[model samples]
Structures are given as C-alpha cells and as structure tokens.
Target: MRKSPLWIASFLLLLLVQTSGLWAQSAKKASYRNNNEVRTVQGCEYEVLKGLAEITEVEKTRSKSESALGYDEYSVKFKFTPMEKGQQLMADFGENSFDFFLRSGYDRLPVGPKYLKHYYVHKGQKFAMEFLQTDDKTCREQYTYKSMGIPNDLFEAQDSIKAYKIQIAAEKLYKKEKEVNEAKGIAMAEDAATQASGNRPPETAPEEQPKEEEGPKEEEPLDEEDPKEEEPEVDLNLPSEEELRKKVEAELREKEGLKKSPDEMDLDALRAQIEKEERAKAKAEAAKQAELDQKNAIKREKQAAKERKKLEEQRRKEIKAKEEELRDELAEKLAAEKAALEARKAAIREQVTNEIRRESCVYDEKISGTIKVISVEEGPTEVESLFGYKEYVVTLKFKPDNYADLPRKERKLWDKTFTFKLDPKGKSANPGATYVRIHKLFKGNKYNGFAQRLSSGVCNDIMVYSPDLPIDASQVRK
Candidate 1:
C-alpha cells in the first residue's frame, strides 16, 4: 500500500494544525499558572510597598502585539535587593528574580539608565523603591523617596518638602509678628493712661495749721511796744487777702470756661469772621478764574473751528482745480484719438476707390501670351499667408501677343516678369502649363478671376488658359 503525494501532504498539514493547537493551549496554561503564582504571593488588594533597594539587574521581556491593545505590550523588568538585612519582599517574581515590570515600548527602559547613573554617582547608594499592587493583580514599580512615601524622584521630593516647610514657617512667623504688634499696642495704650493720670492736679484741700498754744512762753519783754500786737502787720506792697481771693476766683472762673476770657472769646470770633471773609474771597477768585478759563477755552475752540473750516475750503478748491485739470487732459486725449481714427478711415477709402478703378480697367482689358519661363519656389518660412494655408512662389515670364497695342504703363508691366504666391491646393497657375491669359494687373487689389495683389507685393489668382481653349470674348474684350 503506497501513499499518494496528495495524501502525504494532507496528513502533514493536519499534523501541523494539531501541533499548533496543542502548543497554543500549553502556552495559555503556562501563562495562567504564572499569573496564579504571582497572585498567591501578592494578594489581590490595592497596596504599595516601599523600601530602600539597590538595582541589581534590568531585563527586557518578549514583546506582544499591540494592535488589539491600545498600549504597548512590551515590558521592562527590574531586579533589586533590599538594603536591610533579613528583609524579604513578596514582589520577587519567580525564578527570573524580577521584582516588578513596567510596560514600555522602548528597547531600553527610558528612565532606567538615568536613574542607575544617579545611584552610582551617589556612591552606590540604594534607591527608595515602591511596588504598587492593584486589586486587578497588576503590579508596577516606581522610584520614590522614603520620607514622602510617594512615587517621586528623590531630588524632586526633597525640594517639594523643603518648599512646604519654608511656606509653613513663613506663615507661623507672620502670625507671631502680628501677635507681638498687638501686644505692643496694648502696652502703649496702658502707659499712655498712666502718664495722663500722673500729670493731673491734686483735688484734695490743704491741711490747717495746729492751733497756737494758749499759754505763751515767758516773753523777752516789750522793746517796741510789740508792733505785732498793736495792729496786724500790713505790707502796702503786697495785695490784700481779699484782693488775692478775688483774683483767685476770677482765675477759677476762666479755667472753668475752658481757659478763655471774654476778651479772648471776642478775639476768636474776630479771627473766625476774618477766615470766613478770606474763604469767601478765595472762592470768588476761584470762580472768576474758572469763568476766565471757560471763556478762553471757548475762544480757542472757535479759533480752531475757523481754522478747520478755512483748511476745508482750501482743500475743496484744490480738489476742484485738480478735477478740472484731469478733465481737460481727458478731453485732449480723446480729441487726438478721434483725429487719428478719421485720418485712417480716409486712407482706407482712397485705397478702396483706386482698387475699384483698377479692377474696372482690368475687366475691359485682355492679354494672352506664351509662357517663356515658369518656375516654383518655396515661400518665406517666417511669413505666412493671410488665410493660414501653405503657399509657393510661382514666377511667370510671358511675351504678350498685343504688347504694342497696350498703354505705356501696361506695356511696362508686360515686359517685366510676374512673380506671385499661390496656394498649390487652391485654384492657381501650374508650372508645367504653357499658354497663360491675364485679364488684370494691379498693385493693390484682392484676387478675383484675374490678377490680384497681396500685402507682400506679389500677385495671386492670375487666371491661366491654354491656346486650344476657347476664349470668352465678351468677358475679356475692352
């Protein structure tokens, strides 16, 4: 029993399909097993673990398709060892020794090299590591500072903490300063009250002298009859007690009246009146000044308006003059153009009249001759015919049979060779033909059934007839 080639090929394809399906199932089971193992170690609860760790190694894992997934399926794995002795982390993932992985599309982790350089530069110092585990059993690794316990670089965290402390200290200092100022104000107010009280006059009355002893001591006796006993000693220079008492009463009244006497009150009233008068005078002066300023302003405004009007009038005149000048120039230009046009029309009329006269003459005249020479020539390449057709120059020299009977001007033309342009495809003279008849010869005439002149000073449409052909005598006779 021999196997056919087709059967072998089909068998191989079936085997391949079976093997691929088994392989896919095995891969899926392996991935699920790995996920289960990871989940067992890292519980399915949102948590973050932080520790100081040294980066031992970095690795790139196999890349998966990203078409179905929005983000890159490639991952970068990091392996690190805890700095503290006897410290163990559940983040250690399987035999690969990777603590966590970061989803990245780059061949090399973008931030890994820079972070490693910083670590080595700081004398192989350990970095603060953070492992984040979400409820979905996904794990991510990031660098952090232990003090902040947040996912931020060490330097950035330090700066932020320092700025926050500074701000807090500034606020505290401001509050303290405000409290101290308030205390100072209270102390100043208390001191001011104390000083005011100490400076006030005492309100208590003077104490009376003790009564004089009733028994007098032994006197030295009576030298001057005791001038003190005769009458109360009186000093004429000093005011009497009664007078002093009245003066004191008057001073008390003045003090009770806020220290102003009647005369001083009158002086104050006089000063107030003077101030009022001065104020009224100043007000009047101000009013006069304001009125003057208003008048001046009005005058200036009127002057400005007048100037504006004058300028407007002058501008209008100038515009009018310019308009008139332009109109005159336009009229002159139109006149010149009209004169040129008229002259051109007159020239065209004269040319048409001359052409008609020549045509009439040619209609009545007749000439026949034997062709002495006939030749064809290529026309000028640069100059095309008016009808946009290809043309050739044909030269004909003829000896007319009636040369002696023709007029002097006609005879002169008959002696000369006639050269003209003609469309080879249209009605034209042929070079191989012999006898030719010409009914007209003119300088400036269009092609009819006779000779016609072209703008190039050549003749066209000169009718040719062989000698055997019958002549129409009525058409050719004078």
Candidate 2:
C-alpha cells in the first residue's frame, strides 16, 4: 500500500525530533579542559596552561579539502592513546575562551550548512590536543598547534564525567542503527516467503458441492502448460580480453609518445595545469569583485567630500556675515564718539565766552592807567530788565599778572580802583542818588579810596589814595 502524506509528514517530524535531541545531548556533553591533557607522546614533552591544551605524538599528514565548507583543514593524528577511552579531542576555540570539543569518535555530526565547513572534527588513532590561542574569549575558533610549539604546565585539574557521557552516547547511536538495519533485513525475508507460498498450486481435492452448485468448472489454459518459446538471439559483439589488452597497449604507446614531446605533460605537469586553471578562475572572480568594490568606495568618498565642502562653505558664509556685522557696529561706535567730541568743543567755547564777558574795566584818566575790576559795590546806577533785579554785591576776578605790578606797600591797601554796578528797581542801588557810595572788598576785606591818587605814575609805586573815589557812569559797559 502507498504511504499516506500525513504518515510521511509524521515520520519526518519524528525523525527531526530524535535527531535534534541527539545533537543536543552531544553538545551538552562536548566540553573538555584545555589544560587537562599533559601526557607526553613520541619523544616530545608538552606543557598545558589554562585555556591552552597540549597534546604530544602529533603526526603530519596531507590536509584534505573535502570539508563541509569546501576549505582545507589540518589534522594531527594522536601518537599517544587518549586519557579517556573512546573519547577523542576536537579543538574548538573562539573569541577569548579556548575550548576543545570532546567527541566519542573522530567522525562528528556536522553542525549545519553555515558552520559545517567552517568548523569540523576528525578522528585519529592516538593524538595529543592543545589550544594555541583564540580569536576572542567568547567566539568559536581554532589556532595553529604544531606551529606555535608547546606551552608550559604539564597538566591541569578537571572533571572527567563529561568525557565519559559523550562516549556512552556515541556507542548508543551506533548500536541503535545496527539493530534497525538487522530488523529491516528480517522483515524483507518474511515478506518474500509469504509471496512464494501464495503462488503455490493446491495439493488436496475439492470439497463436496453445495445446493446451488456452480456451472461447469473452468479448465487451466493450455498455453500455460506449453513449454517456454526459445529465447531470442542476443548481440555478443563485445571485444574479448586479448583484444582489449591490445587496444589498451596501443593507447599507452600514444600517451608515451605525447610525453616525449616538448609540450607534453608528466605527473607533476598535469597537476600544475589543474591548479593553474583553478587559480585563474579564482583570480578573475576576485578582480571583478574588487573592481565593483572600488567603484562603491569611490562613490562613498565623493559623497563625503561633497558634504565636507558644503559644510566648509556654510562656515565661511557665516564668518563673513559676522565680520560685516562687527564692521557696522564699529562704525556706529566711532560716529557716536565724534558727535560727543563736537558737543564737548561747543561747551568749551561757551564757557570761554562767559568768562571774557564777566570782566569789567576800571580806568583812571588822571594817570591814563586802566585796571580790570576785581569786585564791585553799587549804590548809584539802577536799572531792571526781565523780572525785578535785586540789589547785590558782585565780585570780579583778576589774573596773577594784573596784581604783580603793584608795589609791596600798595598791595597791603585793600583797593585803589573801583567800579560800580546798579539796577534801577533794585532797592539796594539808588538810581536817583547824585553821589554813589561804593565799597571795595579785596583780599576778603573791605576798603575805600579815591581812584586818581591810587593810580601812581609808575605802575609799581606806593601812594596814598583819597577816600570816597568816584567813577563815571558811562565807563561801565552796558
């Protein structure tokens, strides 16, 4: 009977489950100590360190290229027997941690399509194992063992239970497959016997007829009893052994003649030709891929350069804008300083004009000498403008040069010249008074004198001045 689709699917699923379980069991028991094996093999002694295992008795052999990943992997068969029976060393290291795959036998289950060719294990008669180094502490890897030489530390302490477990598992699988094959063979034999018996003729006579008997019994066909027809003629033109030998010998002669030619090949020559072709194919593929990669790299570089240039331009524009702004700000500041300077100059001019205008002249026509007034007291002239002017005393100032001409004795006298000022509406000054009384306050003191006698003929002479000096009203500037 044909198998149902459902049954086939169930069988496949069952097989997957069993196979996964087996691999899982093996993986769980695959751990080994890197520093545990310190035994000597051949004539060489090896030391093992933590995460670095060393095995002796390593035999050199040709590397095989038929690994799952299509790469050549090196193998060193053991010279000394393994420490644990039925347990073999399979090196597996990666990242920082070094590991050894503890296998029951040399032949190991391939991991998967991805990792199968990349990492593999092989069985050997008697071999030592060691880990030279690892790619990292956390990745799977392997290193050159014989090339790196051996490490120090003969052995390390570790549990051996795991190694035993793997050995037991491998044995179980091997026995199970053997049993299955034997059982299949027995079942096939029984099937063949049953088929043979069913084809045999009856040995006894027929039973008594029933009430509703069948019509006449059918007789066997005569053709079945006839002897088999003679077999048809067969083609037998195949060459005899001697003819084949002669043909082979001729072919060998032709090959020998070709070898004698300059262009012909020997064993090594034929091997070199195969390797050269392989290398050429590999190089061509690599060159094509490299060209494609170069194009991609150039594209990326151009993009990066464009971006950099764009950034540089933006920075330059920003810097230029800032420079212009600074220039504008500096111009505004200078303009403000210039305006302030002009205002200060104008203020100085106004101050000088006020000082010049405040000076009053005190002239003595008797001696035709004139002196600038230092102080004034007015009771004569009176005038008012812009609000009512009040009577007041006014003080004037003189430079050092003006007093230097006076004699020492004359300098002691308070005043020798006088000028008066008045406002009409001011009660302090009487505009109607004919004789105006004036007072001189000099050197912070009061004095009165006539102006004519005080104006001595010589500018530095000491002289007496009559009291109650009078001055012309027109002499004062309006």
Candidate 3:
C-alpha cells in the first residue's frame, strides 16, 4: 500500500499531544529498559518513564480471576516467533492506545496484527523523529533528528488497519456483480424454455370412423378344413415396425446433424440452445430495425430543411416588397411638401414689396426711447403734422458720473438734462435719391443702403435723418 509522508506526520502529531511527556532518545545500538523488564529490538529502544507500552506475544483469552476486567479476552490472536537477541528485531503484535502508541525511548507500535508498521527501529535504517528534539550542542542538531538517521526516541510507526478494512470492503463489493450476473443468466434461460414450449401447435382432431352394415351371415362350422386351401398366399409388401424405427433415427442424424436424439437431451442443454437461438434472432431483428430507422431519420431531416428554405425565401420576398412601397411613399410625400412650401414663400415676398411702394416716405416719425431728456416733451397728436409726417420731441434727463461724491445741495443743481428729437422713420433728405424709402432708415437713423455702409464700414448713431442736421449750439433753436 502507498502512503504519504504527511499522513505519517499527522499521526505522530496527534500521538504526541495525547500521550503527554515520554522522554524518547535514539542511537544506532541501544535497548529498551522498563524497570525490571528490559527488551532489546534491533539497536534503538524505548526507556519508559511510565507504563505506556508492552512487548509480548498474542494468545487465546484466558479465564480471568474475579474482580479483574476481562479486556484481553477480546484482543486479536497473533502468530509470531520471537527473533534471536538483537537480530534485526521487529514487533509482530502490539495493541496501541489510540491506533499507534509511542514513547520517548522506543518506536510507537500499531494495534492488532501489524504493529511497528514499516519497522520503527532497526540498525542503520534512515527515519524521522517528531515533537521536540534532543540536546546535541549545535542549533540545527538540537532542532532536528540525527543526521544519518532518526534516533529511537524520535521515530514513529504507522497504523495500517484503515487500509486493511478498505481492502476487505472492496473485495466484497467486487464479487457482488458476478453473483448477480449468474442469477440473471439462469432466469433468462428458464424464460426461453417456457416460451418455446408454449409456441408449439396444438394436437389435431382424430378422423371419424364409418359404421359396418348388418347384412353378413354368421360363422359356419364346415369352413375349418378348407381354410388353408381357400386363402392362397396373398403377399403384403409393407415394412416392419423395427425398419420404421431405424428409418426415423437415420433421418434425424443425417438430415439435422444432431448427435443426440430429441428425447435424450437434458433439460439444461435444451433450454440453453433455445435461449441462444432466440438471442440470435432478436439481435438480427434489432439490426434490421435500426437500418430502417436511420433511413426515416435522414428523410425527415431533408424534408424539414427544404421546407425551412422555402419559408425563408417567401419571407425575404415579402420584406423586399414592403421596403419598396415605403421608399416610394416617402419620396412622393417629400415632393408634394416641397412644392407647397415654395409657393407660400413667393406670395409673402410679393405682399411685402407692395406695402413698401404704397406707404412711400414719411419724415420726422419717431419711436419712444430713453436718454438725458430734461427739457421738454411733445407729441404729434398735440403739435399737428409738419411736412406730412408726425413730429415728436423728448427731454433728456442728466445723470451724474458718481452721485455719492457730491453734496446734497450741489447734487440737485448738477442733475440737469437737455432736449432732442429722435426720428425713427425718415424719407431721403435729397429728393433726387429715388431709391431712398421710409423703411431704409433704422432705429439709430442709419440708412439701410449699400452706398452708406460701403463708404465707411460703420452705421452712424444719428437720430435725425436730415443730411444738414447740426450739433453746434448756434444752430439750435435757443
């Protein structure tokens, strides 16, 4: 059996923790000394601090004295021959405390049959030690086992009972299938014989006999002497009974090649032959049925593929037609919308041209605005028309740069304003410029003409549209 080193180490670790302290030491040649009993096995041995292990042979249970527990009665019976003193000794029997037991001096022994599994101590054998180390001066030597090998106190033996139990269980399980198969074979053979006997044709009905007529006379007493002469040799050439029997046997042997007669065959052989023939026939039928099934499967798959392809083609055609219809509809709708939009834009352009021509030019027309208008305010409704256009004037209010710096008295004086007129709509000042229209001047009185902007790339901020308008105080109507 195979074993891992980790398994042995784990076993040793558990053993050390449970058994408490047992001072174990190792040497190439040594003996186990336990009080009065001193046992030597190979070179290394166990020096017991307590009564932990025993070296003895296994025997049948003996009658125990009263008051004593009969524990040894249930122990395993072992067969062993003790080795000569110090001749590569190995323990054949040991009932460990828990699986395998060890002490500080000698190796741990396994319970039952195989104790000291994979020998704990033998002269010059390499092995390992566990738990703690011995004092050997150097730091490495103190922590580890002997360099060439493990000392007797360090080495541990394994327990093989688990492996043995598993092997036995496996053996039992292995034989179970064969037993089942044999039983199944017998049952199958019996069934074949029963069915064979049942399938034979039933016995046919016996032929019917005709009744004799009652016209014949009774036997005469004078015919006894003439009996031999009357019936002159009528020869019948039919075969004898023995010949018929021989003929049947010859036919059976020659025609069917059967060495044994039908009645002579034993029940078991007859049943076995019947089962074998039935099995052969069943196998043949299964093979034939499989072939037919394969053909049908292939036929169905091909038909399904053909139908799938046809359906896919039909769907593709429908999608293509729908796409064409949608494309044409979209194009026609877009064309009609474009035509209607262009016609509407043309009508609006014509109406705007007519309005500009009919209204003509109007001068001195103003829109409301904000400025420093402190002087006066006038409206076209009160002043009446001047030159066929409304005249409106406004006063501008003065605002200081920084009101916070001025005294209250001086602030009122400085808060004065001027008056000016803003002509929002104006006609050309030069009547010769026929292109000038009322709408050409913007809110700042800047003319919306190409010549005005082309001369200087700036729109003038003039409120009065007249070309001769003045800003000098002398030109004002003071």
Stretches off by above 4 angstroms in model 1 are: 1-290, 351-478
Ranking by lDDT: 1, 2, 3
- Candidate 1, clashing residue pairs? none
**Tens-digit lDDT string for candidate 3 (1-478):** 8535544554555457335423232242233322322322322332212111222333334333311222112132221222233321223223321112222332322222222333443222322222112222222122111112222332222233344334433444445545656888999999998998875788899988988878888877664475456666867987899999988888988888887766887989789999999999999999999998999999999999999999999989988998899889988988877775665456445534543442343322332222332332234431222222333343334334455677999567445543333221222111111111332311233221110111221112223223333222222221
Alpha-carbon error at 399 in model 2, in Å? 23
> 46 in model 3: Cα distance from truth in Å?
99
Best by lDDT: 1
Q: Native-vs-model 1 lDDT?
A: 0.46
Q: For candidate 3, what is the TM-score?
A: 0.22
Q: Candidate 2, which segments miss by more than 4 Å at Cα?
A: 1-267, 347-478
Against the reference, the lDDT scores of all candidates come to: 0.46, 0.42, 0.40
TM-scores for all candidates: the values are 0.22, 0.22, 0.22
